[model samples]
Target: MWVCPGEADPELVRAGVALIADERGSVLVDAGQSPSHAREIQAALLAAGLPAPRWLVYTHHHWDHVWGACAWPDVEIVGHASGADLLRAEADRPWSVRYLREEVLRNRRLGPSFRARALAVDSWEELRILPPTRVFTDEVELPTGVLLRHVGGRHAPDSTVVVVPDSEVMLLGDSWYPPPAHLRTPADEPDLALVGRLLDDTIGWYVSSHSAPMTLDDARRAIAG
Candidate 1:
């Protein structure tokens, strides 16, 4: 329950769960979609029932990973300085009209498949959730002893990539938004090519906002082939 499907995005919304370790309390890599979806993320934390979250981080300002942040219990929210602005906007509007149309169709026809999509778009305007108590430009450390670095100018204005070498895992929000069919599709299409370059240089063992952890070799091959 602690690391199943995050609420950040819906369509192929596979979740990347908590990277639990004995040395440190659980450091939730990212909060999911709306407050409701965040509750879903919390379900996993609840399920773990030990080493409760000491803090939470955001991959970026994307509505899916942020709007749901209000559900967190006033934990320290970490991110690039620009991330809060993005989240503020998210709680102000529904997704683009095109996105909503897709959501309606996916919900009505796609059945259970729409769960992720709904999580990403549902209650967006009403929730207005994201509020990062802490902000940083480049990097920050978690009480659990994980180091999160803000990989700049790759995915979005305030894109963040969280790394915890002790866990030997890195949480990449939508930078590598997994395609519905398991393709290396960039969630931020405009920065797709650029982001790929950053991933090449910085990441090793990567996890998507919605998929399982991917090894460096797998990530490179997914990009090249």
Candidate 2:
């Protein structure tokens, strides 16, 4: 597995992207925030002698997670059905500094902080939104023995988790995060019970979207706390 850690800042927001490979090509996790970011990941994979990815899977439909889909045109994109719908809706909307600034002012959900991150790109006009080409309901298991399961959360209703039972690792992809303060969207607490059920004795390493990977016990305590 190869991972490109995410970065969070007032001026930029980038979620992590990962690759799980086997003798039969590879499967990518998130797509990052822009074409440049995606290229960086690709270059790293090339340098590491990893197989080129055949599929890109989204953990959710958030901008920071799926905006980089434009860069991986050759790879098939997969995501939750609701996430695809959200991305399709976003694809229909205009993306520009002026538009984003206006939305930041008018749309409470798109706050000023988000605007800053969105405008951090070198060229806003070059930004292109691509929804997932393939979507699934419930869960799907990749040939790599990776499991993608929907575990809706306040952060994103279409949130998904990737489980590698053999490796005993799971990518949480912000599924355990609280709803963004910008959105102020009313939501229930995170479903720690469901998360708990998934984190059986087999799983040891847990990766959250923004933070470094943590031990299974640490993950459980963090989620419960």
Candidate 3:
């Protein structure tokens, strides 16, 4: 398993991209924030002598996690059913800078912060919003024994986690975080119980999109406190 670290810039949202590979092929955790960011992941893998990804798995439908689908045209994409539905809604929308800036102004769900994150790209010319090619509900195990689970939380309804058993690493994405203030929702809380159930002896490390990888014990502390 290899991880291409994401940017820490609050205005520029690039979530950590992970690669778990075996003899079968590689499975990528998130597509990334933009074409440039996706290509950066590709370059990082190449530099590390890693195999090209065969499957791209989304942790959720947020722009930072799914916008880089266009960069991996040949790879099969897997996303949660509900998250795919949200992406499908914007599949046809133009992803130009003007459109994004306008969306920031008009869409109640989007705000100035959204504008900063959405537009932090090298180039929007190659931008294309492609929905997932394969959608699953609940949990699915890949041929390589990597597990993906739909554990919705306050951060995003379609939040998913990827578990690589051999590596004993779990990709938490943003599932552990609370909802953004702009979202104006108070209904959901972090599903620590469900998260705890997955953190048995098998898993030793947990990686969240925005933070460095944590030991299993550290993860538990973070969630508890």
Candidate 4:
């Protein structure tokens, strides 16, 4: 009963678009904002017949995406090979350094946003950086009754997404958001080109980690966009 649907994190609803599931021992994609926020996601999953999660999948190292991952059982978690570095970098840069500026104190315009992140953990070092149980340079597959493809160059250098071919479903990280055509910048813009080629080479539907779901044709069109 692995549920993969669009969800929101109460703390930062605007930035949250989660993917949670429970096929065998709870495998949640993106453990979410913090432990409290993850509990909220857990409640939702429970209400929908899914249990608390024991494992997780990090789409990238965005603080809003994978912070509370530690709260989950340190089962066989997975992500891109570069994911660990990205997570480690989370604690490297100051909370204020996210927005490049003359100096940390010189930046005053980012007050509200600053406060939100000021509370963030300055170093992911104590957090273990959550290594993937199986890291791959190019691709990896999940044998849980589906073929999961770990893709790079969608959101971050360590960005990744999965696809269940038989179900015609794709768990696109931040590579794409459908039905909306404004914010489509990716770590690898050329990835857009590859998306079209992927769909043409195969037949399936696509679902983003954040926005609405799309079909194979939709993926091709969006890739072309």
lDDT of all predictions, in order shown?
Answer: 0.61, 0.81, 0.83, 0.55
* Residue 221 lDDT, candidate 1, scale 0-100: 69
Candidate 4, residues 13-97, lDDT tens digits: the string is 2234344343535456676655555566667776876666555667666655676676566556777778776666665654334
Q: Which of 1 and 4 is the better model by lDDT? A: 1
* Candidate 1: worst-modelled 10 consecutive residues by lDDT: 176-185
lDDT of 1: 0.61
Model 1, residue 6: distance off in Å is 5.5
The parts of candidate 2 lying over 4 Å away from their true place are 8-11, 185-194
List residue ranges in candidate 1 displaced over 4 A. Answer: 5-23, 91-126, 176-204
| lDDT for each residue of candidate 3 in 1-225, tens digit (9 for 90 to 100) | 988777788667678999998898899999988887788888888889999888999999988888887898689898899988799887778766778778877875777556755565667777777788888999998887889999897788899999998888999998877776467467756556766766867789988898888898987896687
lDDT of 2 at 55: 87
Candidates 1 and 2 compared by TM-score, better number = 2
Candidates 1 and 3 compared by lDDT, better number = 3
